[model samples]
Target chain A: MAALAPLSTYALRLGDDALILGQRLSEWCGHAPTIEVDLSLANLALDLIGQATHFLGVAGDADKLAFHRDALDFSNCLLVEQPNGDFAQTMARQFLFSTFQELHLHALASSKDERFAAIAAKAVKEVAYHRQLSSDWVVRLGDGTEESRARMTAGLDWMWRFVDELFQMDELEAKLAKGGAGVDKSELRAEWDRRVDAVLAEATLARPASRRPVLGGRRGHHTEHLGPLLSQMQFLQRAYPGAVW
Target chain B: MQDWPLWEVFIRAKGGLSHRHAGSVHAADAKMALEHARDTYTRRMEGVSLWVIPSAQIISSDPADAGPLFEPAEDKIYRHPTFYSIPDHIKHI
Candidate 1:
């Protein structure tokens, strides 16, 4: 077992996940395939950003944590930091992450920490909509034209490697889970698989073969992609420290 | 795709309200259309209920015939209920 980290660390991890993903989704604001899709992606981005604010607020100053952190200090899962490849790829990322987040939020709703429970309880509802929107797109694209089916397959393959990391248990989370203040994410894997598998089956798409899990985001280690993302995200803050609207 | 059909969206603001046309969305099917309507029109908690119908399915009277279709009803003053004496309890009427 590794040394226990503070409870704020746990909150920061969750916040980073939401913040980074929200930022990624916001990249689609004017670029989505359709106006409706653009609106929907923006809405999802707003919801995730709202969640991040609450979680990061619990950890400390939300603005400082969000704007001041370097790429190495961000504990968000690597899945979120991946570039939004295309529409299908974006939906695939959304499908996989939202499914896991909905379940995680559901579990956290029962947390012993009232603050965590309150945030999770409210966020779970928004995440449910995110899950539905993503899964529906997965099914539509997967079961549509041959070209669409092909793109959907490639999208899932691109994202499959990161699935395992979402459920990986770490020492900090383990200690918090033991105290009923956090979730034992590993326990949610079975249900995540069931839900994801159902969507794949309905989409008429095959599950991507499991590969060696990509790990280390929880420990502040990340793929090459996160650096550019952090650079872009932190620019306004770094350029003018303490600048505000 | 550009080939997707247009869907007219209707939103019911509350329990007792009738769904009114809010706007339109483009989608491949009814299910997708409904979701599109929800995302497009109801993001601000504007509605408790929603309805989406294929724009092609809606039948509209030809504008050229507007005089024959509706002008005759404009002169019917008896259709108005203003002559009725309302009791104090009948606030809604």
Candidate 2:
């Protein structure tokens, strides 16, 4: 296989993150607890899919990259690929991921690469809303009835191990960071912690105790959940072979 | 979910327009109601401003009072400025 250029690789990684998360959120389209919540989740999914299109388009044909890639080839962080266990679980995952994404995208909006900067600029606004929506749910569920609090706590615990992998800067990212083309994700951790902590405090929820970090999505390894997700997402394109709307 | 209060959503389509009733949503409180209103009504660039009122708080006119409230106005056609003979150049008025 031909080696990808550093910029192409960077775009592909970010694209994968958006695409996978969008697919997960799209699962809530008709099944969310309420019609209003359903529409909101779908709106968030559409925004992520749109962001994926821009980022993946920078690497190559967006459809080909999204529909043709296997699970082992995707570089999304593990947090996004996890199942939407329930409303609280989905909110926990979205809150954690969007908090980090908002910070990282804000930093990338000023990147030396104009394409990255442009995409990040637009996407950061959408992510800001995602963060707000999820954070509100976290507070509501965490501070509500006893059952809600237990479920929210469990949801946070289920996702906490994957949080560390989001900030792990690989050598490629380090090199790109030095060159001003990519963000140093490691640096975003402090603010992510501060913001996440504040929300947890408001929710009256204790932060999950840190566990051994589950890593490797950046290196194309993923949790068992991703394979099934990709199979569902890629099924139509894979079966039809170049079908169009 | 069924126990949540209903909110009537009003959306101002643009800066100069008054908020018009768009639809209704169900939410636990004022904040969630606003968020729900945005998600439900404004996804298509339809509004610049949003207003969400608890459905119970809006005192709508009774259908049984239609004759007493509205039929009295039907014969007062002079209330509308139809007698004005303005030039065609005055477009809106």
Candidate 3:
């Protein structure tokens, strides 16, 4: 492994994750359940987009990196591309992703590379709010009422299969983990387990029993879902090329 | 599924800075209130800190109270800083 190759790839992976999820959140713009929620979704989308900009820009491939590249060029894990099911589904995905990302960002804040560390430091602040927001929703929808509870549990259940994608370390991640540039996804697993358990217990939702885990996001092999997402995302960029407002 | 109460936001621009009331947001609960407060008030790098209170929980000073409660202070010249000189090092008022 050449010096910094893995780290750059690792950053690109995370950046793609943020970019895809940001696009998903933006889809809910002006269509959130309430005005406050609309703004909340909008705000989260912006935060993720900001992260994408820093990470992808550093890669020197922001366009081919995010908007212009083919799906295989993407390094995002599978969990993000899972359809935004319902509000409960969205919150469940958010809760899990935020919890994972918050820990990842926290570890990255202390990276040996000053640039990566600075990016992490700025990012963790925003990720903290995102984690809190998602966890709160998990509790609310889980505990609120019979219908709400049912919907939320179902949402979590439907999305549960995708959770393993968060921990799927690729060849690059494994290589980077040997250095301090990357956090051990295994260490993140423990805290993620505890935080998720507590939230689910409070939400009155059940964690899915062990199931077959899905993989392949890091290497760019993905479910059919990624295609539509890429098509929509790339359309403007492909069509406009260099058009700017 | 639950109707979270609304909260009004206030932002303190820096540490030790006064929290000026900013604006309001709707949230599903108290936790959401805090997140929304930070997002709405701090997005432009405008605030270093935030305060959020349920809109339902606030008690306000009214226009009716201004004459009696605030007018008297306007005449207290000693309370004004005209008599004293502030050091150049003084940062936030």
| TM-scores for every candidate against the unseen true structure | 0.96, 0.97, 0.84
Could you give candidate 3's per-residue lDDT for residues A9-116 as a string of tens digits? Answer: 877887899999998888888788887777888999999999998988777667767777888777788888888878888988889899999998998898877778
lDDT of 2 by residue, B6-88 (tens): 99999999999899999999999999999999999899999999999999998889999998999999999999999889998
Considering lDDT, which of the candidate structures 2 and 3 is the better prediction for this target? 2
Ranking by DockQ: 2, 1, 3
The better candidate by lDDT, 1 or 3, is 1
Error of 1 at A135 (Å): 0.6
Candidate that scores best on TM-score: 2
RMSD of 3: 4.5
Per-residue lDDT for A83-113 in model 2, tens only? 9998899999999999999999999999999
lDDT of model 1, residue B19: 98
Q: What is the TM-score of chain A alone in each candidate?
A: 0.97, 0.99, 0.95
The model with the greatest lDDT is: 2
> CA lDDT of A57 in candidate 1?
96
